[model samples]
Structure formats: structure tokens, C-alpha cells
Target chain A: MEIYELTVHELLEKLDKKEITKEEILASYQNRINEKEKDVQAFVTITEQEAKEEIKQKANNPSKLAGIPIGIKDNICTKGVKTTCASKMLENFVAPYDATVMEKINEAGMVSFGKLNMDEFAMGGSTEHSYFKKTKNPWNLNKVPGGSSGGSAAAVAAGMVPWALGSDTGGSIRQPASFCGIVGLKPTYGLVSRFGLVAFASSLDQIGTLTKDVKDSALLLNVIAGHDEKDSTSADREKEDYTKALKNDVKGLKIGVPKEYFGDGINTEVKEAIEKVIEKYRQLGATVEECSLDVADYALATYYIIACAEASSNLGRFDGIRYGYRTKNYENLKDIYRNSRSEGFGAEVKRRIILGTYVLSSGYYDAYYKKAQQVRTLVKNEYAKNFAKYDVILTPTASNVAFDIGSKINDPLEMYLADLCTVPVNIAGLPGISVPCGLNSEGMPIGFQLIGKPFAESTILNAAYTYEQNTDFRKNKPEFKN
Target chain B: MQVSKEEILHIAKLANLNLKEEEVDTYMGHLEEILNFANIVNKAPIDGLEETIGVNEAYNVFRKDEIIESLNRDELLQNAPEAQEGMFKIPKVIN
Candidate 1:
């Protein structure tokens, strides 16, 4: 196999045996990007020159992932890299210092070679909302690799990068990973530090890993997860080595399948794919049962209210005063703030900012924002109840396989429905991983998510790891060409 | 719940976004639909439930007030659209 096609574990094994050099590994991926980037368009900046220089400097570093390349989602701050969140407002914004996650990855000797694209401000489910470019699904060019982490997922699926960092707010990372036939793991809310992540919704936003398989997800998570004084919401727990969770045994493990997920909008093919996995788990001595999670009905609504309200408040800082785009036609301070934002943000982002503003507006707070917070408590309580009976809960990552790029973009409400399956986890602040389950009739990939209790990333990772070992799904990698 | 043009413009003003003449109606429609959908949270039986701002429940996360070297001053202004000798220059506010 080509070096670019190898997983993080495989490449590390080869490097330890002295069978491959870091230069060869870099050259192989560089070649892949050259051949496939035009079709994939998964990056805002391909840091090839920087990666070449870092390979020599980081040589013989002690970390297990030394000299490996990883793509960073555009929203994560990387010092000196243009960390545009696919929005024109910050098109020229260069992060002055590394985010906490970036600092750890740098310390681990991983080369961040690209800034993956996403929805403008990480607000949309499809990357078409990006002000820069739309990343096409490597599985089929006409279809969108789900977003707002489409570029990260596409880059990994197309083999442009071995694994990439993605941020999930309302299903961004997992949806894209599922659509592109890759593994994406959103660590529990506080598990990973969020100091440098461009805040969308402070409560729900998390930095996660998008990789080819479950072990790669585990490896990347091990590097980025930890507490930090920089992020107030960071979990102050003991450090964990997530790779130790890759046990191939699920005997006596209790799994819950929430029936609400398979209701009306879920595609029959996607449901069948998850059912087959449930049967496989049952055969493997795991107990599987249908569970009720009626709170699923209000999750999407609650998610939007809390997410948008926080986003509106968080985004208020960008007013063409300190940094970011400025309007040339401004006559006064208000004009500069108004016109710069109006022109800089895309339509979807504008819609969200407005939605958020209204939700938090004077007369509507009790009806929307405050009520959503109360419902959020209920969502958490429901998950806590289910987690008590089940070690992990299973659901389809996305209701349907990736649709055509423009198919759902025109209708905002329809676009929000794409996140129906994955948004509940973010609402409850739990760890959820999407691993490829099977392919649909149209040949697009279907993903099944395994969700674990808060700070219990190991439980879901182990369950996913077990399922991957028994199924040939990991072998079904997407092949992309110019 | 049909949204009025005044209400849309009111929120837009609050958000500090200047809407184009043609885009206002479109945004108003989309915002209303989303808000109506989000209105479902009102029906939730949340009277007995306490608010969950975040899952960690760790409020007042305080650290020592010791000073450490901060980020470079020059690097922070590198991306500013308009920068002066030591600060970001913006449109005049004072009359």
C-alpha cells in the first residue's frame, strides 16, 4: 500500500521498523494532494512548505505520533496559519498563538499540513455555506461531503491526509465523517480543551478527530484530550490513554437502540444497516434492546436555541474594530460594525446570527432561549437515565446518505433535519463516534454512531473498535482521482 | 407565526448587521420558520427541571492571579484590517 493510504498505526509501525522515512511519507501525501485536491477541495490552506520544514525539525521526537501529518479544521487556531473558519470576515486572520489542542499536537510532533474548510463560522451542515469553497464528497463528486467539517472528512476520505482535526457543533464532524465513509469521534464536551476553537456555541462546541478507522480516532483523541486552565469548561479529570480502549471484546456489553432515531425521516437502508450491526453485536454476546428516548423530539429545537444564542453573543466581538474584515464605505463606528458583518458573513451565517439575536431579544427570551436551557436539562436527564441501563446507545450518524450539493441548501429547515440523528449527543454533552456501517443502494456510505456517557469516550470507542474488527467496513475506503 | 418586516429589521439592528433591501424579506422568512420550529421547546415539560448551562457543572473555575508572559503584541495586530503604531484603528465614534 502507498504510504499516503496507511493508517496512523500502520505508518507508525513501519517507521519504527525503519522501513519508511518521514520524507517518503510526506512526499506520498503531497503527491496524493496534487492528484486529488482539485476534485476534493478540502482545504483552505495546504501547508506543504511548512510541513516539509517541520519534518526535519521534529525528527526523532519522543511522541508516538512524531513526524506524522494531520489536517486541522479551519476553526482551530494554529499560530501563524490563516485559521479562517471558511468565512470572509476572518479571511486574513492569522492566529497569533496555537490553541491548546494545537499546542498538544505540536508537542506530540504531528505535522499540521492543512486547514480544512467548513461552513462559515461552523454553522451549516453542508460546507456549501463556506465563503471560500465547497468540498465535494470523494465518494461522488456531485454530492456534498457533510459539513461543517466537510473539508476535514473529505481530506481524510480522499487520502489527502491520514487523519484530520474537526470541530463538532450540532453534528458537524460526525455527519461529514459518516457521509464520506470515515470515522469521526466527538469527545465529550469537557474532555478536550476548547481554548482556541472559534466559539460558535460555547456549551456545545468540541474539538474532535476524523480518521479512517476507530483506532485512528482513538490515537488522535489521546493526543488532544486533556484539561486546561485556558478553557474554563475543560474537564479537570485524570489524563487517559485512549488507545488502551481498543479491546475487541464486547461480551456482556449493554447497547441501547433508541427507537425515535429510526422513525419516519430515517432512510430504510440506513435503518437496515444499523439493524445488521445490532444483530452482529447480539451474536457477539452483547445485549441489545430497543429503548425509549422521547426527548429526541425537542433536541434539534433546543440545540438551535442554545447554540444560536451563545453564537450570537460569542460572535458579537467581530465588529471590524479589533480584527477581521472592515467595510470601506463606513462613515462611523456603527456603519463599520454593521456593513462589515453584513457583507462578510454568508447567507446561512446571517440567518443564524439573526435567529440567535431574536432568541435572546428582550421579549422572546423566556419563550425561546431560557426555555431551551430548561429543555437542555431534560435532554441531559433523559440520556443519564438511558446510560444507567445501557453502556452505550447506538443510532445512525445521519438519517440519509449525502444528498446532491444544492438539493437541501435552498431550504433552511430541510437542511437542519440532516442533523436529526447526531444533534442529541451534543445537546446532552456526551461522546459519540460515527464509524462506517455499510453502503446504500446509491453506493453512498452509511454510518452508525455509538454514544457513551460523559467522559466515557473509552466505552464508545471500545464498542466501535469491536464492531470494526468483526465487519469489513474499515476496508471499504473511498478512492478519489482527478 | 408570521414575522413582520419591522421585527426582522429590529433584530437585524440589534445584531449589528445591515440587511440589503432585497435580502430582508428572505431572511425574515427563514428566521420565522426556524423560530416557529424552535418554539416547540415551549411545550416541553420543563417546569420542574433546573437549567443545564453545561454538563461539567463546574462554575467559578478560578485560577491563581499570577502573571505570565502573554502573546506577542505585534502578532495580535497582524490580521487587523487597520492597525496603528500599537493599536487597531477603527472608524471614529466621538463627534
Candidate 2:
């Protein structure tokens, strides 16, 4: 069997059984990276030495995912590695410390594949905003693999790695996974430690996993999901075995179909694909009910305001005088900041920074920023009410299949709407997953999302797994090969 | 349509970012549109509801306030692009 074709569980078992040496697994991944990376453009940097050393150490004692290669989103800080959030501002910047999640990944003995490309400062929905390069969808080189977490999603989709980690603040992980035709999980806010993630929108940002299948995603979540002292927002709860919840049956699961999620904006092909999945669920003894998350209609408006505001504040630390990139032709302090930021940030990053600052401005705070926060409470309450009644909420992961890279770049608002279905979960701090439901007329994968109650990731995983087992969607891998 | 070039400059300063003269006009246009759409959030009936800021509403992360040793000056300056004698090097501030 091809070593790289092995899933997380299979790779771990092989490592434990000594069927494949750590060096051999590393060589196989490197070979795949060498052959497929230029076409996929999934990674910003590939860490050959670090991965080799990690695997060597793990070869001594095996762990859950020991010796498995995983791609990391560029936004998460890895000690001594360049953690550029796909921005020129931090182009040469190296983090001095490992994020709390990175520390956990190290302890679990997984090999790092390197930093994957993302939207600059995690601002846009399409990966085109990345300063370095746009990551292509593995399904078709011309189309995009969702934004921000595009690289992570594409890497897994193209079979470069068995699994990868991506951060989701307003659907960065799920939307990409949808476009790439893989499984992505955005855990309940604070489910995974955010101590090391470069803050895009503080309250909305949460680390998640993107994998070839739901089982790998669950296994990845088990290793990375937990509380950390470094992140004050990290939930202080006992960790549970997420992998154990994978095999549960979804018979009689109450799935809610939010009326707003199925409305006019969704692509016709995508809608049909999701409806077919709903019918399948209904046939499997699960009850599907049409419900309304009333506040969801205003999700994009509320999300952008709050996210930009928080992003503006969180990104304040990247002054040129510090560790990151600084302008060379600056004469004074003000010039330094002005020129550094002006030259460093890409269009999308600058757009968000301006929007964020506008919302937080003195006179307009009440009308824009504060009201968005107030509306956020309403969105949260709406989810709470729905979750009390239904076991899970189902919707299309994105409004459409992956479009061409340049198709939405000229229209930022149009690009922002692409995340409509996934953003509400971020605002409400709920756990959501995107699994391959079906393919559209163009043959691109369309994902259906499952949102669960806070900390109810197991329910979402179980529901998705049951749907996956019944459908032939998993058999449809992108034609891209090594 | 509520945004203006002067307001854009002010907000940029607050964010410690500098915008180009040509770019400010474009940014002003886009920011205005987004803020106009954000106005819809004001109509949300959140009356009598407490504003939720953080998830789970946990706050006041007060530790025992124990003293931690600082890294040596050399170590601290290791990552700094420019430094001089335990101080970050910079152009003269007062112009």
C-alpha cells in the first residue's frame, strides 16, 4: 500500500507495528510533496527537517497519531518557524514560542508538513488574497479551494497529508473543506485552545481540523481539543475521546433545516445536492424538521463588523519596530508605521483593518460596532433556542461550489456572502462540521454542514459519519494525483 | 455612504496604519458601503438583553500575580530586527 494513502488510524497502526520506519514515512511524504506541491500550491513553507526530527523521536514511543504528517494553517504560531498569516507584514517573522496547540501536537508526536497558505490576516473568503500565492482546489486547478484555510483543505484533498489543522473564524475551515471535498470541523468556540493562533477576530476564531474523512477529523480533534492556561478563553473542561463518538448511529437524530439557509442566494445545484442528503437522512429513520434561525439572515453583516473590529485590535501588535517586517526608507516613527503597514498588508487585510477601525470609531461605535455585538447576542440566543429543540442543524456549507480564483476577487461583498451558512455558527460559538454530501452538475463537491449544541461535537461527527456511510460521496476524490 | 477621506485617515491613524493618497478614496468608498449594510444590525431587537462579549461569560482571569523573571537583554533582543544596548533601535522620535 502507498504509505501516503494510509489514513490517520492506519498510519498510526503501521508506525506502532514498525511496518514503516519513520524515515520511510517522511520520505514518502517528501516525495509526494515534491511531485504534487507545485501544482497544488498548498503550502507556504514545507518543513522537511522538523518533520524528520519529530518522526525520529516518535519512533521510540508511539502515540495516537505518531509519525503522521499534518498540514498547519499559517495563522498558528509554531516555535522557531515562520508563522506568516499569509501576509508580507510577517513575511520573515519567526515565532519565538509554540502556540498551546502546537505544544499539544508535538506531545502527540505528529509530523508537521509546514505552514499552509491562507487569506492574508485571515480576512477574505477566497484564498486569492494571500500575499504569497493562491492555493488551487485539488479538484480542478482553475477553481479555488476555500479561503483562509484553503491551503490546509487543498493539501488534504490532494493527498499530500492524511489530515491538517485549520482555523475557522466565520467558516474559514468549513467553506474550504466544502470546496475541496473533505471533512472539516469547526469545534465549539474555545473547544480547541487558541493560545497560539494569530487572532483574526478574537471571539470568532477557533482552531479546527480538516481531514480526508470524518474519522480522521475526529482523531485529530481528540489530540488537539482541550483547555490551556495560556488562553484565558480556552474552556476549562475535561477532555473526552472524540474518536469513540465516531461510530454512533444517528437513528432518530432531530436535524433542523434552517429556512434561511435554503433560500434564494444558494446555488441551484448545491441546493438540490443538500436536499437529496436530507431525504437520505429522513429515509434512515432520522427526523428532519424545517426550522428558522431568524437571526441568521443578518449573519454576514454582523460578522464582518465584529470581526473587522476585533481584527483591527488584535493585529495592532505587528508594528514594524517589533519582530516582523519593517519598511526600509522610513525617516521617523510615524513614517515607519505608515510605510511598513502600507506596503506589508495585502488588499483584503487592509480592507478589514479599515472596516474594523471604522466600526470602533468614536461616534459610529453605537450605530455599527456596538449594534453588531448586540445583534450577536440575538444570533446566539436563536441558536440556543434551536439547539434546545433539535439535536443538530443542517445546511449547505457554502452558497456555491468553488468558483474561479479571479471570479469574486473584484467583488469583495460577493466573496463575503460565500460564507453565509458557516458564519452563524462562529457568532453563536457552536460546533459545526462540513462533510461531502454530493457533487454538483460541474462535478465539484458540495458539502452539507451540521451544527450542534456547544460542546456537542460528538453529535455533529456522528450525524456526519452516518450520512457518509450511507452515501457514495467518499469515493469521489479529486483527480489530482502525485 | 457615511464614510469620508478625513474619517478614513483618522481611523487609519487609530489603527497605526497609513494609507496611500490614491488608495484612501477607494477605501472610503468600500468602507462606506460595508458600514451602510452594518446599519441593519441596529434594527435587531436586542432590547433588555445583556450584551454578550465573550463566550461562556467567564472573566477576571486574575492569577496570584506572581513575579516571573524576565529574559536577559540579549535574549530579548534576539528576534528584534534592530537593537542597541538593551534598547530597540529607532529613528529619532521628535521631528
lDDT of 2 by residue, B14-71 (tens): 8877778888988888887776766778778888776777667857665567888754
DockQ of all predictions against the true structure, Cα-based: 0.84, 0.65
Ten residues in a row with the worst lDDT in model 2 chain A? A59-68
Candidate 1 per-residue C-alpha lDDT over A1-482 given as tens digits, one digit per residue, 9 for 90 to 100: 88988999999999889999888999999999999999989999999889999989998798878889999999999998898999999999998989999999999999988899999999988899999999999989999999999999999999999999999988999999999999999999999999999999999999999999889988889889888999888988998889998899999999999999999999999999999999999999999999988887699999988888999999999988888888888788888989998888889888888999998999999888889989999999899899899999999999999989899888999999778888989999999999999889878899999999989999999999999999998888675422
Off by over 4 Å in 2: A15-19, B64-76
C-alpha displacement of A152 in model 1, angstroms? 0.5
TM-score of chain B of 2: 0.75
Candidate 2: tens digits of C-alpha lDDT, residues A1-482: 68876777777778679797767777888998888888999999899777887777787655656677888999999877899999898888777778888888888877788999999988877788999998999888899888879999999888887789999999999999999999999999988889879888889999999988888888889888988777888888988988788764788899999999878899999999989999999988899999988876577799998898898888777778867788897878888878878788888888898888888888888887777878888898898898888999999999999998798887787787777899989998999999998787777899999999999998899899888888889878787532
Which ranges in model 1 have alpha carbons more than 4 Å from their true place? none
